[model samples]
Target: MSLTDNKSAGEELLLSRHSVRKYEPGVTIPEAELNEILELAASAPSSWNLQHWRFLVVTEQANKEKLLPIAYNQQQVVDASVVVIVLGDLQANEVAPKVYESATPQIRDMMLGQINGAYSNNPGLARDEAIRNGSLAAMQLMLAARAKGYDTVPMGGYNQAALIQELNIPDRYVPIMMLPIGKAQAPARATERLPLEDQVIRERF
Candidate 1:
């Protein structure tokens, strides 16, 4: 089959997804389904296969209450079936050997050498790569949720410091984004998009 045929459903899911702020009050996502969605999202690509993304799924009412203030009192923090805190591990390169455990010894050594060379003494590059990988994982999560008939909203309006303290997040893990997933309470309003001609370039900007 052609790419178009293979991607028709995926395209629909991507196009139909919107940031859902209001969710059904009593609905909860099944644990198994949540795990499956997370697995799919974790399959997103990472630099050197480091896979630095870490998800903190908050679903308990008490924990959600604690996160509410940290999230600037966003109702979705409590209303959604689950709120996933997507984090990036700044020290992900430390695990380069483990990440390439199944590879041939020579390949693993080469990967480790490359990772160490690129990341050691380069905090800025490591941080950038972590954020980029985490962002890809977050987008994959949102699309995966949509494929499961769930609505989601990616949030970045929280107080990062407060969230870290409240959640007892490790220092190495940087908070990248938050996603609230659940069934929508109401239909999402139509949104306008910039035309392809305005945003796309054939060769040069």
Candidate 2:
């Protein structure tokens, strides 16, 4: 069965997704499909709908080479069809008016006021929110890729300082994670998971 055929295949997609490190070299993801995956990922919720996540898709071999050293020489950086750099905009709150433009004036004003109040004097809180929202988007991106029959791996093993310099990322954007997506070259190995009882908590600690 094709991965995109069923809308109710959430469980199957989640269960099947694994961190793919090896990919079929020279394969490229179609632009239409890549856009579709990104659209799905953008649907993830964010604080005040700020949509703070920023994605930098790198597919060029030369660019991948530039990222290799920053990624600690991870070979997947070069082999994957595309490497999506997920960034969180620290100044996302500044764009409140645009993000809430279609809302009723009262609602928009109220949300903007709340956003300003929440972020203006709190640098730590702002940074936390950026990471939180960006992480949600990143997870959605991975699931979207999996549902489209693509393999993905979310990687945080990289030199953040060097990456910022290499990519020329803006100071207001924090590097959150990197997702490499493509067709897997080998079968994913099985792994163990903790039981729900041990991982979940009910009502209290």
Candidate 3:
């Protein structure tokens, strides 16, 4: 079910989202609309207000075909209008100064100091924050696509090392996941979720 101008933002988009693995071939998403979806996804919150995600949009058919094998021969990778590779910036703290630039000098310096201290002292935490923040943006991206009447398949299965080498991804960024977005060839398969009683914790597990 495609969204319309009259349909307000609600369960229509959120509840309707499902992993769409098949897409109509050759359909194209205009750059302006694509940019809108991406900008909306970027509005997701991040640690220390430093957004840690980057996107690699693969729009050319030749490149998508090249990515197919690396994505385990997923046909959607070839047919989707675009394949967005979500990347996590491992050294996101480097942007703290800019993120807090509007603050007074004294406050900005204090924030920068705390950020540097934590990230520099704990490499593991830094890496965790990268993935954590990226995953948050990834979800928003998928939902944003749905709101735009597009489908998406959020994928984790891929040759990470090969993708990095093929894409020339920087060492400072971690490949988080791939999302193939396009017009669906068929409707997404229905999925069931665990009941709240079964999965939700009232307070603590």
Q: Best candidate, TM-score-wise? A: 3
Q: What is the lDDT of residue 136 in candidate 3?
A: 95
Question: lDDT tens digits, residues 1-205, model 3?
Answer: 5434456667667877899988999999999999999999999999998899998999999999999899989899999999999999999999998999899999999999999999989859878999999999999999999999999989999999989998999999999999999999998888887876998788786
Better model by lDDT: candidate 2 vs candidate 3:
3
Who wins the lDDT comparison?
A: 3
Against the true structure, candidate 3 has what lDDT?
A: 0.93
For model 3, what is the error of residue 93's alpha carbon versus the real structure, in angstroms, after optimal superposition? 0.6
Question: Candidate 2's error at 83, in angstroms?
Answer: 0.1
lDDT of 1 at 200: 90
Give all candidates' CA lDDT scores: 0.91, 0.92, 0.93
lDDT by residue (1-205, candidate 1, tens digit) is 7434756776778887999998887688999999999999999999998998999999987888788888889998888899999999999999798989999999999999989999976769878988999999999999999999999999999999999998999999999999999999987778877987988999876
lDDT of 3 at 139: 97
- Put down candidate 2 lDDT per residue, 39-147, tens digits, no spaces: 9999999998999999999989899888889999998898999999999999898989999899999999899999999898786987999899999999999999999
Error of 1 at 136 (Å): 0.4
Looking at model 3, the pairs that clash are: none
